[model samples]
Target chain A: MNEIPQIELTGITRVYGKGEIAVRALDGIDLTVAAGEFIAIMGPSGSGKSTAMNVIGCLDSPTSGHYRFNGVEVGRLSQDQRALLRRHYLGFVFQGYNLLPRASALHNVELPLIYKGLGRAERHNAAHEALRKVGLDNRAHHDPSELSGGQQQRVAIARALVGSPQVMLADEPTGNLDTKRSIEIMEVLQDLNRSDGLTIVMVTHEEDMAEYAQRRIWMVDGRIERDERTRKAA
Target chain B: MLWETFRLAIQAIFRNAMRSFLTVLGIVIGVAAVISMVTVGQGSTQQVTADVEKLGTNVVMVLPGQDTMQGGPGGTADPMFTLRINDAVEDQIASVALSAPISQSRARVIFGNENRRTDIVGTDNRYFEAARWDLNRGRFFELSELQSGKAVCVIGETVRESLFGFADPVGETVRIKTLSCEVVGLLKSKGASTFGSDQDDFVILPIKTFHRRIAGNTDVSTLFVSVRDGASIERTMEEITALMRDLRRIGRGEEDDFEVVDMEQFATMLSGITDILTGLLSAVAAVSLLVGGIGIMNIMLVSVTERTREIGIRLAIGAQARQVLLQFLVEAIVLSLIGGLIGIALGLALAVLGANWLSIPFTPDPGIIMLAFGFSALVGVVFGFFPARRAARLDPIEALRHE
Candidate 1:
């Protein structure tokens, strides 16, 4: 028996609205990703790159497709089942570094573990370890707004990593950062990919950000325009 | 999981303190109004019962006519209706410890320069026993005075004060309209009756004297009957009704022209009316609770909208939609519970003050307190559902892009 891929999408289509106003956000897309692979999705605006990321994240469902995650049919799962899958298997990081404004860095990072039903002490320790990985452990008690842009994004990354998810999905993780902070975020991703054997899926339009990934998939007009292995895994 | 949700909800509420307080204000007023109104009403009912009980327990009044008029000692006599339970009917009921047939008429009493118009009650020596009247000075009318129909009277506290000032009026004579009656006794003060009439205002005289000189007729309108202790009042009242019907020659099926008014029945009737009034008032006040709940819902909706991005972050971090819903719902409940607590305290304070002002007993009803609190919580659940569902149903993708 052959080992199953981490994620497989066959003939996935996602349509928005209805009638004449209908828009095909993801049109008949097929893709497969192996375990421990670091991939980047790159596209221009209105090319369905973000929509594809949402579909792959299980935050949006495909209109017609087979979505399998680790040998299980995810497309057939209920909303709560998808949530449970996300709880144990996936981590998400957004361009906005979407940490709760009123919550401290530690609390923001503890969110995923809290949903995992981990005890308070266990959640705190795991969140602290993740923050240490992102080099934001010292700023754990500060509110997200009180931290700089780079530090806030680091807290979000810590939140994603705290639950030890099988895959980390980052939607333009450094989109709001300057060159200096973008490099800092890219280095952290590079370190995780190299040292932890963590699977990672990132979406970005920047060529420099895409270069950090070992593989690149380019989307155009709701379909994959190009797929290539750009570099060998570290 | 619920505990964490509750903690998060509380934290979120405290994040915007001013907004939270304003949101709960309506609930506070509503709960306070319901609690205070119910409390004061219960107090009034208790007051009415106590006042009636003070009139003399286990006392039944047999009036000459049906319940056509309202007053303790005054009832109109009809010329055509001829059911009068005479003094002989008093002796027929075995449960009767004391009974007195009373007849009343208005009279202007004058002694020296002081004069006042007052109610003149005519009854036998049993009036003191049945009506629970006490004497402070002088003697009650002797058997000779009652039989001879002599012009002798016992003045109540108010009557004695009006006609004789602080001076003793036991040996003096006071003119009653046309007849001059000797003041043979002074009755003790019983203060005011429940109906606001001064119990110490009426003057008492021998029944025969009142009939021969003042009324010019031998008729009694009310028979005050006090039952013996430990006797069944219902059975006694039934016995009295049967005897009265037989004496009046009324058939078994015919409605007796006279009605027996029991003090217990009167108390129950008065309290029933109070309970209805309290319920109505509390219900009206509960309308404000609805408004308060709506306020909570409105604010919760606004909060969910305002925190769309936060919600998106929570969703992406693997929070179930139901968890989000539970969080907001618990927030609403916490707000109402706090409001209920404060309202209970405020209501109790208001009730105490109202009791003093209204001259009723301060009776705190635990049942009403619990009811008000439980109703407030229900308001939370009922009004909290829509907003929470809206929050839970938000798409994480759209919420992430809300800003």
Candidate 2:
């Protein structure tokens, strides 16, 4: 099979500050992501998971690394290039839900497509399709503040999915939800991975939450501690 | 894309409408004050020129005893001494149109029911044309009356007004010192001089009458000479110089004891001083625009700080660094442009009001209006740079993290 990994990171290291005060946020990390793999990163706080997410999301630069995304070299890309990557190839859902409080859920979902230069009607259709996938089509016109926590998260997920990105990175996608809502969100993520063939990378501290992914990677002190794969249910 | 950015800029301004208006008020008032002050200064100059032209076009004024004047380089004050001779000036001058001997004194006058103060001028009929005057009610004194030293006088309009109000003082007798003279004619109106001196508060009589009845002497204080029509003033001035030297009985190398003035050159000389005043006023007013520019800079800086999050959102949503910079810069430019437009309106309105107050014509220069507006836009660009650069250089990640 000649299909290469959709994303790859090799010997990646990030340094901050200078001399004695300097610290490494990521150390000698290597990883590969298949086109449709659903992977979870489990780590304690400040284990560089969020920092790695920033690098993977193209919002930041890694101090030292050879990072490849979708078979293209990404480490040397310019700011504009990374913005293009974020626009065309990657989607993001952060723990804060990050939906603008004043914007309606429909506007929030259409925002990514708007930046992609889609027409208004096309953007509306895509946003509605994504919102329907997340089971929040009825909440599309509600502001983030007017919606419940689970609904807001679904709107955020819809925003991520609206662009039809190759990868969706969810950082603690269910961190702010109760047990029932958390399962519902995980079910949505699982359905996307199973039915849509979208590569999913989730960051979580909960073992039960990470167990839902096909593969798990553990991190500590800015370094990878373990890698494990869960067996398919018989 | 530019249209979208423009819409966003306008929207941002309207989002805090009152704050934006208050911020631009400094620029508005500053520009308006600048326009009004300059227009007022120019209006006064134009009014003065019109009034001076009424005296006589291309006329030159000469004065006697230059050594008797005391002031700074450009200071204007009354000369301390008077010319003592007029005989030489009467004969030697060439291309002469009219020449009149004049002497003056401050006098107290008494009429039928009024007492007033006036300048007592002793001159001939030639003084009328030289000074651009016409009789208001009767003919000028007859040549027989002029040569015979008759005790007759012509009063200026202001003198008539002060002594008679709406009544006709002509054909009536008034007393100056001990002489009782009939007002044979009244002079037409001549408004105030640039220095606010009353050009109409004067009495005109033949030089012969003034010398015999008032001064008890043959000496004349000054000579008012009018050159031939279309004659080069310099030629007549040279002739007057030779005439004065001969009439005063001075030797070839000795300076005559009198002076002659060309009214045209005198008007230019006076205008030169006012031009300097106008230039200085404009310079001081220009500083207000500069201060207005600084006000824009301060407000833009505050705006950049206030809109940090919005900038981050824009950048994240695909705005280039230059795009962010352009957005802020255009916001400032739009603000200053609006200010300039409003300032022009307010300034022109004030200029019209000022014209009425000063009793002059209302005129607004289109060039000055364009200049004021252009200056405001230039201020926006020059002063808004730092704030725009600050916004463009902000880290999007840090901005996203910022509240």
Candidate 3:
């Protein structure tokens, strides 16, 4: 495709501390992802895969580099401007399923829309549609504690999709799930990517989970060691 | 957005209801103490003012002692000096409307078979005029009767009830100590004074009759001097002080042996003392408010720490730092406002109960209630700022990584 990539990074570096004890989490690197692509990033514990995801999600700034989200340089933007960008275009899912424990599944799905300043009726309708897309419409009233691990992950996916973001960044989406639950989450994410043409960047160590993506990028020691295509682009 | 923040805050506060209530308990106690103390103090001051008004503000009491508060010259002066002071005030001072020498003692009075111990006052007819007392029936003492030192007396309502039991005692003969005195008049009823002493429990007789028969000595304890209406009490007091000093042979640079106590000044002094006490107590109570604010700050800090992950989640979900700060701040304000409302109710309740117990008027000041409410809100803002800012300034990555 000749269209401009949705995300572009050039020479990104992230250092954690000061001179002597400083740890460089991500060394100089460059990568780009086009619209509607499903990509998975994989590495061992200290390989800086999570830091790369954080930079892509606008949750952390690079030490010295350019991060272009939709071709707009994100590194130069203020903290509030970046937050607005995140609100309007990006969604994230964490390993812990980070849904507010006290809130119901529907409310968790409605969280992003609330930050988007949507009206109550619009938020409810959109949240319901997102939940139905994740095959969790019947479990909308249940709290996170009441839902199974796979169900909770589905609710989080619904929350990410409710904002109608251009990209979804999921860190260890199936890290806490059993084999069956992991497959269930991976199938829901695959179906979303193929049917809705949603772009996703997932960080995971599981090879089976990475197979759900069309392309896989492997990180090692703060740099990308390999990038390979497992399937043709949808 | 603000409404959403408020709703979130309320939900968080309700999540740990017991802890929230305990956090605001200090504010409740502090506000309650301040409000109740001031309310009761105001009520007492009002009562004192009303009592002094009843005694007639123009009346000045001349006692046979120096200013008692200063621990100055103690004990009564010479008995003849009191009479001389009264006579000098009556004859020399043009501002003096009426001056009467009064000698008092407690004595038992008997009528038929009923006898009771009551106060006996010895004075002339000018005493009734100076005291603004009225005769309910019969008449006051004639000039000849006072001059001849006749054993004629006027009975107060309390004595009349004790001795005659609602019977007309105007012409009844009652024995006072060892002398048999005829009741020439009946005094009207005057209720309890400021000190809760019964004002209608005394019998009045001529000073001469009291000096010759009951006391066996011409000793006048005090002089009641009433200033003329529209005359300056300060000027009249200065003149009386000058005349009394001249008559008592007290020289310059020496304190007078007698004290001229203006009823108005006494009332003012009483109210001033209560006001000072109330202010001191309120200051102490306000310290507790400061402590309450600190308590709120401590709890807010703890809450921020405990909710670190939640803040991270909110931040990651595109919530602005200002929005997170606003959430915590609203929670603190709502908590303290709840405490303030409870304190107001408790304080007003205590004030009413205290007023009834102390027999003072219940006076709840609306201005104080408003001040307390506004102060609590201010406390919430001031103390909640640090914790809220800390929460806002948190690094989302580090916060999310927190266990």
Candidate 4:
């Protein structure tokens, strides 16, 4: 299908430190993702897969790059502007499920909406809806510590989806889960992609987890070693 | 957004309730110390003023020697420098409504077995008028007694209680030194004087009797002059000085042997001393407020470091850097504000208790209260900024990765 790309990156190079101690975290990477696509990035430790996720999530800016999101150059935006971009256009789920330890599941899910300056009633309703989407509406009052690993990840996914963002960025969504819980999480991602037409970019080290996405990208050292479309799950 | 941030800040503070309370303890003590110190100081100043004012603003004292002479002339005391303010000089000052020539000597007065060594003042009927002393029992000595130099005396309330055991001493005879004097009157209790000496601890006798007996000298050591109502005290003092200078035959530029002191000026000087003392005490107490600010800063810095992960999550969820800064800053301010409020209550209670125990007036100064509260709030802002800035500038990725 002919469509404008949702995200485009060219010559993305991110280096840490300087001179003899400098390490290149990202090396001249070029990538493109269309709307409604689910992609997985796989790499070894220190292979820059997380760095790529950060840059794609707008949590970090590349040292030098021409990165575009919906035809707007994201690298040139101010820090606050980038924050606004993340606020309205992107959602992020970390491997650690970084929900506030003291906040309840509902409050955690409503965090992005709170940043968006939504009304209290609107935020409550939207958070309730998001919790229902993850099938955890009954546990909306439970704290993160009270929830299982799979339930916490679902809560994180609900937080990411609460904003109805243009793209979902998940960094090792199933990193801390068992095989059954991981499968459940993968099924939720597959359902969102297939039915809701939501775009997702995920980072994982497991080959089986990577198989869940429609496209798998393998990275070596800071560069993309291979990118190819894979068969959809049965 | 501010409300949400405020709620988050409160939650964060309450999460470590003990730490937050301990952090604010410094502010509590600082505010309480400053408030109580100033309050009690003001109360003492008021007490002094009230006591001095009770001595009568229109009254002035004409003591022997120059005004600088303390303790009735120093070692090798010269009789020439010691003023002989006799009855003749009192009659010469026309600006005074009345004047009393007074002499004093230390003597033991014995009635029965109860005897106390106390000051024995020698004056006339005019002494009661000039000193504004009212009689509580019996009658003042008659002009006839003063002129005939009778051995009758008036006992003060303290002497009456000490020598008579609450019984009237008017008709009783008390032995003063070597002479037996009849107590013709009882003076009212004047409580304590401004300088903290007991005003009701002495007995008064006719000056003629004192000159013939106890002191054995005709020298009047003091002159109590009462200016007429609507009469200018400064002008009267000048007139008294000129008359004394003329009577003493001291030419111009030759220092007079006597001094005239207006009670008003003395009262001002005493109050001024209290003000200076209060200022010094308040300054010393203010230092604790600064120490309190440092305590808040230390706790805030710890909170910022400990909550680094939470800050990162907030930033990642699209919180502006300034919003995060405001959150922590407001938290610190709330802590100090609450502490300041509690301290004010405690300080006022303490001040009232202290004033009661010390028998001084409890003076609550609103200006100091507002100033103390404002200073505590400022302390929070001043000390909380750096930690908030550090939290705001933290890199989201690194913060989220913080263990």
Give the per-prediction TM-score of chain B. 0.72, 0.82, 0.79, 0.84
Give the per-residue lDDT digits (tens) of candidate 1, residues B248-329: 7889788777888899888888889988999898889989988998999999889889988888878877888998888888
- Ranked by DockQ, the better of candidates 2 and 4 is 4
Error of 4 at B276 (Å): 2.6
Tens digits of lDDT, candidate 4, A1-234: 667799999999899999999999999899999999999999899889999999988889999988999878997777777788888988888889999897899999999999899989999999999889889999999999999999999999999899999899999999999999999999998888888889999999998888899899888889999998877553
Off by over 4 Å in 1: A1-3, A18-20, A229-234, B62-95, B100-224, B230-260
Candidate 2, CAPRI quality class derived from DockQ = acceptable
Against the true structure, what is each candidate's TM-score? Answer: 0.77, 0.76, 0.85, 0.86
Retained true contacts (fraction), each candidate: 0.69, 0.15, 0.54, 0.54
Residue B140 displacement (Å), model 1: 11
Q: In model 4 chain A, where is the ten-residue run with the lowest total lDDT?
A: A225-234
Per-residue CA lDDT of candidate 2, range A22-105, in tens?
A: 889898789888998899998999898877777777777888988999778898888877777877888877676877656689
Models, CA RMSD each: 6.0, 5.8, 4.4, 4.0
DockQ of each: 0.57, 0.25, 0.63, 0.61
lDDT of 2 by residue, B31-95 (tens): 78878877876777777777767766545545656554554577654342233444344444557
Ranking by TM-score: 4, 3, 1, 2
Give the number of the best model, judged by TM-score: 4
Model 4 misplacement above 4 A: A194-196, B66-74, B78-90, B105-194, B198-219, B248-254
lDDT of 1 at A1: 92
**What is the alpha-carbon lDDT of model 4 when measured against the actual structure?**
0.86
The model with the greater DockQ, 1 or 3, is: 3
